[model samples]
Target: AQSVTQLDSQVPVFEEAPVELRCNYSSSVSVYLFWYVQYPNQGLQLLLKYLSGSTLVKGINGFEAEFNKSQTSFHLRKPSVHISDTAEYFCAVSPTARQLTFGSGTQLTVLP
Candidate 1:
């Protein structure tokens, strides 16, 4: 199965702090990358995707990631985080179907 795994179940950071959401994946042929964020009691929103080209990809809300083929991983990073950034981050892989195989889930808490 084309799947992705997020190592961190939860990440806690103070307001204006930096944070990272780690993600790894395993696929046979090819796959599409996606990062979704979910606020409290809300549906997931597409944060970013890495379809092709440059390994380093930038996303919304000052977030970015680098696709490392050798490491078989794609990790999200933010320089300075805000309280609004507090939410659940999910790493997904789209192999063939539109349905994305999501990670367990990660709760990012930004304290004020």
Candidate 2:
């Protein structure tokens, strides 16, 4: 089984500012990492994933994440954020891509 930890539960950022949502994971076996965002009254949307190959993975809405094996981290980052980017961000890990263990979730509030 794998587990994820989101460093921040709530993150408030001004519009157009760079932001980083920290995520770390622990697993006995190899795992795939993912970042999902949920808007108000919406389902979880895949933001980015780190399955293999590249250490730096980019996703929709100008979001990206780097997989650090040494640190056991896959932190999500956005150079500039918009008001629409305000949502709940979740970090998930799957050992077999079948079952996922999700973090508590990080509320990204983009302020004006």
Candidate 3:
């Protein structure tokens, strides 16, 4: 069985504040981790991924996450967020399950 869990549904932070989005997963076998961001009505864009290398992986928009095998978690973090960072973030997993399964989602609201 494979599943993804995002602890928070919404995160409100002032502009230039740091933020962290939590994500956990369970799978019988190895899996590929991914974080995607969607702005308003725009399509989802790849934020980061954990394939088969270093635990710390960096992606676009100054976002990054570390894959913890023991904890089975991959949490996204950003040092300072801007108003443009306001959007929805989703954590996903891709095993041999045919397709990727996404988390409920985390809506990041950055206030000016």
Candidate 4:
């Protein structure tokens, strides 16, 4: 079984400022990590994923994340955030294709 933790429940950042959303996972076996973003009144969208290969994975909306196996962390980073980037971000881990674990979610609010 696997579980995920999103360190911050809410993150407020000024527009165009760099922002990072921390995520950590715990599992006995290897798992696939994913980041999903949900805009207001919209469904969740895939932001980034770490399945295999390069530890550094880039996703849509100019967001990226680095997977650290030893630390069991997959933290999302954005060099500059825009007001449109405001959304609810979720960190998910899947031990298998059928089973997925999700974090509490982090609400990122970009201020003008």
Candidate 5:
């Protein structure tokens, strides 16, 4: 079984500020980790992924995440956020079950 948890339900950040969204997962076996972002009234888009190799993976829109196996965590970070970056972010994990388990999501509200 695999489960994902997003520590924060909502994050408020000022424009051009840095932000970090914490995510944690638990699985019995190896898994692929990912971060996705969804804009208002839109679908989800892949932000970053961690399948193997480097723990620090970069993604679109200046987003990045580090895969920490020991801590079972994959936290997403952005050096600078804009008002357009306001969206709902999700952390997902794919275990052997052939389905992706997603976190509750963290809503990012970038205030100008």
Candidate 6:
């Protein structure tokens, strides 16, 4: 069985500061990782994904994630934070031929 874990429940960063939202996963089979962001009262939008080929995957809204097989981690990062970036981030994993498994979300608060 595969499971996703979000270690941080909430993260606060100042504008222009760098931030990383940690995500870890465990699975017996190969897993495709994804990062989704949900703004206030909005649906979950796909940020980035690591399906194959490159370990470093770039996504929309200046977000990126690296898939580390050995560590079973897919962590999301942004070099600089913005006020509009405040949202809840969710890490999900889909194993080969299986449905998506989601982790508890991380709330990102960008302070002025």
Go through the candidates in order and give each one's C-alpha lDDT: 0.89, 0.96, 0.96, 0.96, 0.96, 0.95
Please give, for residues 1-112, the per-residue lDDT of candidate 2 as tens digits: 7889999999999999999999999999999999999999999999999999989999999999999999999999999999999999999999975898999999999999
Off by over 4 Å in 6: none
Worst 10 residues of 6 by lDDT: 93-102
Q: State candidate 2's TM-score.
A: 0.98
Worst 10 residues of 5 by lDDT: 93-102
Worst lDDT run of 10 residues, candidate 3, spans: 94-103
Name the candidate, 1 or 4, with the larger TM-score value.
4
Clashing pairs in 2: none
Instruction: Put down candidate 3 lDDT per residue, 2-85, tens digits, no spaces.
Output: 899999999999999999999999999899999999999999999999998899999999999999999999999999999999
Which residue pairs of candidate 5 clash?
none
Q: TM-score of model 4 relative to the true fold?
A: 0.97
What 10-residue stretch in candidate 2 is worst by lDDT?
A: 92-101
- Count steric clashes of candidate 6: 0
Give me the displacement of residue 54 in model 2, in angstroms.
Answer: 1.0
lDDT of 6 by residue, 23-110 (tens): 9999998888999999999999999999899899999989999999889899999999999999999999998876999999999999
Off by over 4 Å in 3: none
Off by over 4 Å in 2: none
lDDT of 4: 0.96
